[model samples]
Target: MTLNRPDVFGSISLMFWSIVIVVCIKYLGFITRADNDGEGGILALAHLTRSSLREGSRRYALVMILGVIGASLFYGDSLLTPSISVLSAVEGIEVAIPSLSHVVLELGVLIIVGLFVVQRHGTEKVGKSFGPIMIVWFVTLAAMGLTHIAEDPSILAALSPHYGMLFIAEHPFIAFVASGAIVLVITGTEALYADMGHLGRPAIATAWFGLVFPALTLNYLGQGAMILNHPETVSNPFFKMAPDWGQIPLVLLSTMATVIASQAVISGVYSVSRQAERLGYLPRLTVRQTSAHTGGQIYVPAVNWLVFAGVLALMLTFGESSRLATAYGVAVTATFILTTVLFCVYASSALGWKPWQVLLAGGLFGVIELAFFAANVTKVFHGGWLPILVALLLSTVMLTWQRGVVLVTARRTKLEGPLTEYLSSDAVVNVKRIPGSAVFLHPSKQTVPLALRENVHFNQVLHNNVVIVTTRSLNVPHVDDSERVTIDHLASEYDRITHVQLDYGFSDHQDVPAGLKVAAERHGVELDIENATYFISRITLRISDRPGMARWRKGIVRGLAQNAARPSDYFHLPIDRTVLMGAEVNF
Candidate 1:
């Protein structure tokens, strides 16, 4: 009876079309073209868009804000994806053994905790098998789907455009409402786009269209066939398609696939966090490179534990996969909308697209994304509030931190720039020029290091030759070694004072000593890595009572600063030799 209704058909139509509209067109067709030198994410997109405009322009600032919000919201979704994906599969146990349904949540939490615990060790070893494992999972899914499709081969008609069009035309209001539920199929589409940088566009596109898309098509159509044959199975047609004896193995296989998917999502969280750090949206964390051969593979312990805590809370609070699903589409929909907006800007500016071209692509995708976004908004009170709340909170922190950094830089900018006089013999007069080189890690090359100024003001001692170094994260993912370090002068590099600017890709690690050593070797500058004294500044944040963010957020900025990884640790400066000069900053 339900299958005869246009509304039922419309829902399926909307679901299938969304995958084509959002995932296939918006991501694969357009957004993937916006990758920044093999690095992909909201931040990369923002930086790429920023590169097309004049530095310090308002439009640049606007794009940066969108990226920050998207990245923050992504943080919220990353936790949910793993929890929901794993829990939903584990829940298949209920279909296998209805009596064991009670243990699903407990087992899901246990698996999630285990996943988080092993994050510290890095996935370089286990990661190699991911592609093969996923291939097997997908093949298994296709085979299972094939078993049921034979029962009602006519169900394949759902893939035809005429059915979708007729259903939407016959049931307009129901089609509109069904858009929300239908969007669930395309939830991870943005993540696929985000990871395309490392994996490359061709590989990602191949995987999506080649194996994944076909497998998904077969599985959904097969489920549709099963539901049509036995309408009672509509409640859980996915598991219902499998016979009683095969249900247990299906559950086992589903759990394995979900766990693998969840692990990849967790790795994405860490990867995005590092990108945020390099792009200056967040404070630095302790970054550990997992593999010696690959510089990109990294682990952040804090992020791992925080994500674990969030997943744990969601597990206890929602307690059901269905409830978690209610919260899923909101963050993802918002991100898609932002990605489309940003891609429009990038296409118009850098991709050399005409206004009409931008409008055509953006308008089409924007309407679909906005419709889904609005539909998801209706679910806010019903578990959808969690991610929205997390996004707002995280965005506030990012914006506040950025604002605080701005105020600090503004204050220092007026007073500090390259002190040619400080580098001169006159300023160095009576200053005890100590032995060995002193590397001053500064935020800006133009700004005189407060540590350099303070070292002279207090002890009145400076290293024989001073190196004022500032590291810049480029829009791209990897900066070539040839162009990695840029020095101020020519040969011997001004024996008394030299300004060094090191360029790194967002995915590159921040290693002050390594960058310095490489620069020294290339330039023939004298340097002893062991004895070099690294100078860094520690800011004491003070609320200005100034017209800025709310008082609560200023406090959060302070907390972030307090909890941020120490400069010595983050920059890999030798602990015993690193000198921290404390400075007070007001925001």
Candidate 2:
């Protein structure tokens, strides 16, 4: 009798079509094409769309804000994913032993803690088994679904689009509420897009259409069929699908599947955080390369522990997978809406699509995503407010960081002066010529490094081989080795002063020592990179009554900078060979 409710069929229809149209067609088919030089993510997509536009234009700024919002919401979703996925899987134990339900939260918390603890060590070994485990899980899902469908062949009627349409027409309010729950079906779709760089579009598309889609559809339909036959199992239809003896094994397998999925999401968060840092949205974080061969395998301790803490808070507060599910869709659906918006912008600007074509596709996807977003908004008081709150907080921090950096750069530029002028000035030309090379890391080649300036003023000496290394993050994902470094002997007036500009993409690892080594090998730049003295400006900020950012926001920026990873650690520079020149920046 419970299965007779319109919401049951309505939710199933919404979910099925969502996967078909939203995930399969919209994201996989169209949005994946908007990847930034084979990289796909909100930030990368935003960069691609706004690449042709002038950097300081209003449109560029607007698109970047959308990327920041989408990225922030993604971070929110990342926080909740581990808690919900693990809790939902572990909660399956309650079907076999209802009394054990009381320990679900505790067990889930312990499992999540273990997951974060293991992040310090790389996932290379654990990653090898992920494919096989996922294969087994999907095969199990398909097998279970096929068995149930055979028992109730009539449940297949729900596949007809009219069942969903009729249900929505008959019970509009129920369909609206159900839409929020329906969205849980496509939870990992964004992460799939985010990881497109690593797996590539072809591989992801093959796996999704070939294996994942069919299995998920069968599982959902089978769950609906089971609910129809045994109405009392509505409380936990998925776990209830298994027979008494199979429940424990199913629970164990489901837990492993969820853990693997959560691991993917955790890795995506680290990638996003790294990209954010490189793009100047966040401060430099400590990034460790887990695998020497694979540059993409990295671990961020700050993100790992922070997300773990958030997951624990959510689990302790919600105490049930159902409640956590209510909070989940808000961030994810909002991100979907933002992604759709970015795609439309990309289609119009970069692809040179006709106005009508862009509008037609954008309008169709916009309606679907907006409906889901609105539906999820109703659950704000229920539990959805958590992610919204998190997104807002993170967005504020990101925007503030960007703004503060701009203000500080403007001030610091005046102090350091032009690099060309500084190099040719009497202060540098008359200095004592040191024996070895001194590599100074600066953000721009046009500006002098504060460290170099201070060293010249205090020590009154310049290295015979002065390499001004400036690392710039390009809009693309990976810069080619040939185009990676440019060696410029400034104005030919100073042969000893060489300006080396290093270009990197968002996904590329920033290793100053390695980049310099490549410069020596590839560009034939004469230098002792191994024993080079690296000079980094360690700026201690002091707040002033400046015309730039608000004092409070400036303070926030200062705090973030203070806690950021040291330059030596971030650039993988040799610590013993690096010297920190302290400079005071007032803004």
Candidate 3:
């Protein structure tokens, strides 16, 4: 957008240095090292820090608030990335044929809908081609940039940090404003750490250092060189890098690259949403495994369609990339800031980094990201409010759900009472015992299953054999089978009533029936897998004069709980053999 040669050089320098400092140094060198059991991401980083920080400390509270804010902003990034990416790539049509500009939005929407539609089929087949396609895209980017740089070698001066400083010193306000747009260069940098669970750090670092980094550097330099040589091409310098005959092919390739990028972001939303659900920050939703061979290759239909609706609305409302760009930087830069803060916490608390090291590293990235965030803040009235609004809404939902769960769990624990006491109580001693086995799924093994209590109280009968299954979701990515199931005979007097704890990682599949079968086989727990009637507690939450949370927040939690997926479906239990016992609980 800057037509002046000096402005172009300064902007190029700003972007180049951002890549070096924010991405190459901070993320690749520092942030990626702070993994939660080989997993990386904002939430993973939070998980790592939460382990070291005292639970009720102020710092712990800060990390948690930042983590939720970071995660919420991620949804904003997920929504905007696809909209802006597809729109920007499709806008290339305007450069190739100006008369076709009108169809850009139509084409973009079509491509977006098609991309989301195919998500149900899983990315296994199409994902095989992503690496090759991206490699070609990067090569093309480098080649095109090399040609332009050769034409105007003066643009290479942008490699020095002085130009960026010079730009800021000369035009303070303009530089601050330009920082907002410049942040886009490092937009997808978070994914490097976020996807470490799926693709390890070594592979990601190698890919970055070997191919992605060099390609991006050359491409940015080439765009600057081309803009310098032909100032009139400033409006669409990327497409202008190609020859007239190659323009169409370049456009086609750009569209595919954006589609691949969008796919990654969409999948990330699903992964983080699942993580949130497991961590008790969100209600359970139906998760479908699209690839039987690959555990991470799963899809959430509700998230897929909800995001599509948002992306469609953004494309229709914004109408072009430039306008959408205003909304994009706020969420991304905010997330960058959150990640930096969390990393500093992890470094100091977990990694045992000295104060100076932590401060120096954190302050550098914090200032840089904060500047970008402040710059984007100026565009709030224009379109920046969209992401901030999205982040606020999602954060509220997460926090409310978490608070509601705590209150309800506490109340339910009192009502259910201790399992040991209940098993030895006079009521249980006089209860008529049935012949068949009954399995009850509860969140805690220490407490009596609510459904079990209800069944004995109202029906006046108890199963001869009872199994209490508690699925515990740990913060790690995967748990070994050796530690998966722990069998505890609650009482030798009532050996028929056994307690089984099934441990799972956040990424692990939550299949209760399958876990029960494994427990029966591996741990010698007694249970009829096919014939046992699985009992689930369907707790009905009602608002009361509770001292926990605000009335409005409680209502939101109730709505979310009401809309959550059925426990049987989520736990992969057989519907025909499952029974739900309803009970009222006030919060």
The candidate scoring highest on lDDT is: 3
The sequence of per-residue lDDT tens digits that candidate 1 reaches over residues 115-149 is: 88777777676566566778887887788778878
Two-way lDDT contest, 1 vs 2, winner: 2
- TM-score (all chains, Cα) for each model: 0.90, 0.92, 0.94
Task: Report lDDT (CA) for all predictions.
Answer: 0.79, 0.84, 0.86
Best by TM-score: 3
TM-score-wise, the better of 1 and 3 is 3
lDDT of candidate 3 over 1-587, digit per residue (tens): 44777888888889989999998899999888887666677887887788899989999877877888998998988889999999999999888888999899999999999999988876566577688999999999999999999998888888888988999999999899888889889998776667665557887789888998899989999999887778788778899889999999999999999999898788778777776886689998888766544445568888999999999999999889988887778888989999998988889998899999999998899999999999988888888889889999999999899989999999988898998888888888789988888999987778888899999999999888889988887756578778899888875634588888998865677888888888889888878888999999999999998798999999999999998988887788889999999999998
Poorest 10 consecutive residues by lDDT, candidate 2: 1-10
Report clashes for each candidate as comma-separated counts. 1, 0, 0
TM-score ranking from best candidate downward: 3, 2, 1
Q: Write the per-residue lDDT of candidate 2 for residues 1-587, one digit (tens) a residue.
A: 23574556666777788888889899898988777656677888887877956779888889989998999999999988998999999998788788998888888988898888888886565577678998899989988888888988776777777878898888788788778877888878888887665557897899888888999888888888887777888888888888889999999999999998998788778777876886789998888767544444578899888998888888898889887877778999999989988888788777888999988988888898888899999889978998889999999999999999998988998998988877878887778998999999998788889999999999988888888898886756578888899988884634678888888865577888888888999988878987899999999999999887889999999999999988787687988999999999999
Q: What TM-score would you give candidate 1 relative to the actual structure?
A: 0.90
lDDT: worst 10-residue window of model 3: 289-298
Candidate 3: residue 507 Cα off by (Å):
7.6
